[model samples]
Target chain A: MAFVEARDLTKHFVIRRGWFARPTVVRALTGVNLEIERRETLGVVGESGCGKSTLGRCLIRLIEPTSGQVLFDGEDVLALHGEELRSLRRRMQIVFQNPFSSLNPRMTVRDIVAEPLKAHTNMRGSELTARVIELLRQVGLNESHLYRYPREFSGGQAQRIAVARALALNPDFIVLDEPTSALDVSVQATVVNLLEELQAELGLTYLFISHDLSVVQHISNRIAVMYLGEIVEMGNAEEIFHSPMHPYTQALLSATPMVDPETRRERIILEGSVPNPANPPSGCHFHTRCPAAMAFCADEKPPLREINGRLVACHLHE
Target chain B: MTEPLLRIEDLYVRFRTDEGTIRAVNGVNLEIMPGEMFGLVGESGCGKSVTGLSILKLVPHPGRITRGKIWFRGENLLEKPESAMREIRGRHIAMIFQDPMSSLNPVFTVGHQITRVIRRHHHVSRREAWERAAGTLDDLGIPDPERVMRSYPYELSGGMQQRVMIAIALSCGAELLIADEPTTALDVTIQAQILELLNALRIRRGVSILMITHDLGVVAETCDRVAVLYAGRVVESGPTDAVLQAPAHPYTQGLLNALPRPSARRKSLQAIPGSVPGGIEEIPGCPFHPRCALADDLCRSKTPIMTPVDSSGAHLAACHLIGKSEG
Candidate 1:
């Protein structure tokens, strides 16, 4: 069985205008379904406001999903509440995109890494310091960094500290939301390699969310392309990248600049911008900008279906 | 190259802080030919944006141009008065910031914002400026420009806001544009459209461009020539193809290797070790020597200046290894 499965997960935020006014609902995630295998990294790639981050929060119950099931090791996560849910948070940790803002400024590196240990377990004083140092070492830091504050570290080093904190509880599944996006290119590689090494050492599963296609392509085993609030296509990394069936996926891939000058890519520039997510299109959300959109695409919303070991939701696939 | 549209000679920028004067752009010399798209690629704090800002005289407060001159079309821009520089800023030279949403005013309608630029540059009446703004918006592939003009910036998507930004930047008939990571905040599909629009405008109007970004791939695809910056200095510069294919400086090579190329899946990225040094005086040797694999005693003691290499003639590298190997 897959380690984590999100079946028909949905979240809608309701905005109340006033005491007398009617409430308006903003649908962030619309019946999203995904299955993450054990010891595998599943990358969720999308533009801003595409609800990828919302989906991540939903899976981890950081923000409770309005409806549907988040099955973790064959148990319903949303069903758990109070201490049960709190304890489950130990099993699943999250590393936010901005390391500088995520960490506490006043606290030393030791306290930041040991906060989880203090909350979840009963270890403190010198033992806590030792454990924090060990966690730091695991994430490629040294003993001398124990007393340093977050301001003393660079962007890459700050992210390493964040990773060390995430690994404090020895999480089996970690939700990395654009973990390396804020770091420089050369430094991004170090963090990514550290994550890969940690995964191998501890048998961790990851849900990597990012807008950067290059980094996503490098780290992911399986990839899902999200548009608006829906997944347009998903499959094994190689298949999705090499032979993308969806026109949206193809256009997105072709638009990306290949580092090699010899490979002259035919960049398909899609005109117009993404539509407003609060007031999405009625039929197919992507039909407005999709180059290969058909008449039926304007009338009916396609359901996600399996075709050739890939899950795609588009008229062309149908 | 027709007097080289923009010539930057020995430009240096420094910021006076509590610690000391931090040298940002150190003796940078660059020449952008007329109607050519030049790229400045570097990581953050490498002085790419500072160079772009120097053209517009928009460097942040306290960050002053310590030395050097900027010649635009045979005229000295640095010597021009602030009042004259104001006239030059949006009229002849335009700039597009990385974040379009923040750059745009929240209260003003998209149409009014665009027309404001047109009115400032040209002597057109309000009605004509508004009309021209709408026309440019339409030309930028924004469907139903009339409705979009009336809408507020918050109502539009990031891609739409960026398109509006481009429309404003191009509406003034600016001869030169400095785009600092204009498409970094956008998605690939939207980024492609923005790049295409810029290229189209450049070709049609014969406008000179200076694109500042950290992605070398962007340089390869869009730029005719590229300058690789490291720690506020141009480590290497040449024709885009020549530099990307075989980088001369170790920093440039490390950056190229760090990129995840589409052609290879199994090849591991050779990441440069250590982060950029903080403070200008924190490091004594070459700024990149701490991270460079081939750093030696000579590299540690002296800073290497730009020297020509290969047959490109345009290709120049600043490195001890390149200097010694070539000699």
Candidate 2:
């Protein structure tokens, strides 16, 4: 069995309107199936409302999935409750999208890093302080920054601190959600390098979620392309970029602006925005904007099938 | 060659904050040739936007254009009257910003807002203005121009809203369009469409564009000429291909090297250490020297002036080690 396996994961958020109006259910995740081997990163790439983050959050049971089975080392993640759940949290951690918003304004850096250790373990006094110091050093911080608030640090530094907190429990798996989107290019690179170095050193499994394709391509061992809550295509990161199977994935890859001016990519601009997830289009949610969408795409949904070692979901493939 | 459409010389913008004065744009010089897309690329706090704003004298009240000469269409706009500058803002030079949601008026219909700008600048009746607005929106590839005109800003999607904003910009028939991260808020697919429209507008109407963005990819794909800004100064300036191909400034090199390229995966990104120095309290020597790997004792003590790399004077980089490294 894979180290972490997610089968038919789904999530629905009910947006409440006026006093008596009907609640609208936004189908954030329809059905997401994924697996990650030990010491590997599974990258989920998509646009803003595609539910890639929801899928990541669901895998760790951060948010309860409406229906799904997430198996971590042959144990059901959804079944755990109370004490078992708390224990599960120690082994499965998440780094949020924004470092500025994730860290508390009032808590000092030392307190922030030590909070997880205190909650999970019985470390107290000097041992706690020493662990916090060691964690800071591991993430490239020093003794002087121990008592300073998160506001004192730059975006890169704050993200490092967040990474340190995530590593406090020495978790086997960590979900990083758009961790570099808020940072500048220079700062983002440093954070990415740090994450890579940490993963290698700890032999950790990661569920890397990002809308930035290049960042995802850099850190991910396997890449999954999400469109309206469904994994349209997934395979090795290099293969996905080099020869994408799904039309949406191809459009996405071409849309990504290449820094190299020498190679001009054929532009494939998908028309219209992602359909309202609350009232998605019939059959394939991506059919509404897909350029090569056929008549059958509107009436019938396609199943993910292995094509040349890559799983693709499209009517063309069918 | 004829004089460039817009030339900025010794441009400096300062913001008086509680802490102190932040020199946002310091001794920056640039030129946008007619019918060309000039990209001003930089990270946040590098004063790319401020430089764009100072062109139309739109620097917010707290920030003042301390020193500069803005030459536009053979006239020094810095020396022009406030009324003249206002007349020139939309009539000759229009601007589109990153977030269309905020830039477009939420309360007003898209048509009303666009036509209002038309009535303000051009000598046209209400019907002609509405007709022109609809025509512009149609040109922008809005499915139903009339429906989009009637719809409020909130009714439109992010991509549609951006298209509406671009339509408004093109409504004035401006010569120069100052687009400051126009597609940054939209989806990548939508971004491609907007950039295509911008490129098309330049080709069809021969509009000179000053494109300001932090994304090197966007600059590389669209811009004909490029200028890299660092801490309110022009770190490098060259043809788009040359700047991306062979960057001389360490900051420029660092920014490119740090970017996660799609071609290669599972490689560690080259990160420049230390964040952009905060507070414009004029650091001694190079502004980027603190973070630059090539910084030496001399670079730390004295600022290096912009030096041309070739005989064409098209490519320039402000770095003390440029001469040493070239040989």
Candidate 3:
């Protein structure tokens, strides 16, 4: 069995403007199906409001999906309750974006990292301190940082502290939702390398979500491109980067500004922006901005299918 | 040769706080030629944004320009009175920030905000300013400018809001646009569109742009010339192709090497150790020596001055080890 599996997961967020106004339903996820093998990193790439973060939060049950099943280690995760859910939570963890805001400013590093251990385990006093220090060391910090508040640290160091806290439970799986996006390039590298090293050391499966194509292509074994709430393409990182099958994927790859001036490709500037999730286009949500969109694309929803040894969802492939 | 459009010499910006004096920008020098897109690249706390704010005398409270000469078209901007500076601001040079939502007035309609700026700068009638505002928006590829003008800032998407912001900035026919991470808040496709629009504006309108951003990719794609800022100083400056392709400073090289290239998949990235200095802590030598791998006794004791990398002197780098390795 795969380490983590999300089957036909769908989420709908209802926003009520006022008592008189009719509530709007935001279809954040429209049937997302994914599986991550043990010790593998599955990257989820998309723009803002595309449900990439929603997908990550749904996988960890941080936010309940309106429909569908989440299976971790072949066990039905959504059905668990009370102590059962608590035990399940110990195995799966998440590190959020914006490290400083994620951490409690009032709590010291030791208390912050130890909160998980204290809740989940019976370790107390010196034992808890020792374990917290160990976790900090794993993320490249030392004991001297134990008493400092989150405000005392820089963005990179605060992110390291968050990583240390996430590691407190010794999770088998982690959902990293744009962990390095809020950081500078140099500090982002430090966090990325640390995550890779820890993954290897702990044999952890990751659902790495980000908007950065290069960072995702580098760290991910398999890459999934999301448009609106659907996975438009899924394949090996190198294969996807080299030869993307979906038009949206091609546009996204071309749109990404590369660091090397010589490798600048002719950009496919997609007209207009992404459609509103509350009232997306009829068939493929991307059809409105898709350059190669056909007549049938607007009326018929394309199914995700295997093509050229990769999963692609487009009428062009059909 | 024609005179440079804008030149900054020995710029120093300092912030007074309870902790101490934070030297945001220290002895930075740069030159932006006419109709050229210049990029100032740096990580956070390296003083890239402060340098941009310094150009317009818009540094926030508790912060002041300690020392600098901002010469625009051979005139010292620092010597201008408040009245003259106000006249110079929107009339000659305009600025757009990273977040359009915050920068724009939410209470006013897009048309009202744009026309206000237009009328403030030029002696035109209200109707004429409104027409010009709509025209500017239309030229920026915004669809149905009439309808968009009626809507408030909160009603528009991030991309549209940014385009509206650009419309307001360009409404007065400013020659130079100081864009500080203008596209950072938008999505990639929208960012590409905005970058294309900026490049087109530079080409067609002949407007010089000073783009301040942390993303090197953005610099590589849009900038004609680039300056790499480190600890409030320009560590390296050259043509975009040369500086990006063959970066001479260790800091610039470290930054480029830190990025995860598509070709170098799963390979360990070379992370520069230690965080950027707080800018309040005094360092006698090179500010980057603490993080730089090739730091030595000379780098620790003395700061390096900008030296030409080759015969042309167009490309320059400040590093003690620039020629030492080759020798």
- Winner by DockQ: 3
lDDT of 2 by residue, A252-286 (tens): 88898989854357989888888888998998778
Collision pairs in model 2: none
Off by over 4 Å in 3: none
- Write candidate 1's Cα lDDT for B56-98 as tens digits: 8888978999889999978989999999998888788889989
* Native contacts recovered by model 2: 0.85
lDDT of 3 by residue, A1-318 (tens): 888999999999999999999999999999999999999999999998899999999998999999999999988999999999999999999999998889999999999999999999999999999999999999999999999999989998999999999999999999999999999999999999999999999998999999999899999999999999889999899999888899988989899999875556779999988888999999888899999988989999999999978999999987
- Candidate 3 scores an fnat of 0.91
lDDT of 2: 0.91
Per-residue lDDT of A47 in model 3: 92
Stronger candidate by TM-score (2 vs 3): 3
DockQ rank order? 3, 2, 1
1 versus 2: better lDDT goes to: 2
lDDT accuracy of residue A259 in candidate 1 = 73
> Which candidate leads in lDDT?
3
lDDT of 1 at B183: 90
Error of 3 at A303 (Å): 0.3
TM-score for candidate 2, residues paired by index:
0.97
lDDT of 1 at A293: 88
All candidates: DockQ: 0.63, 0.79, 0.90
- Share of true Cα-Cα contacts across chains kept by each model: 0.62, 0.85, 0.91
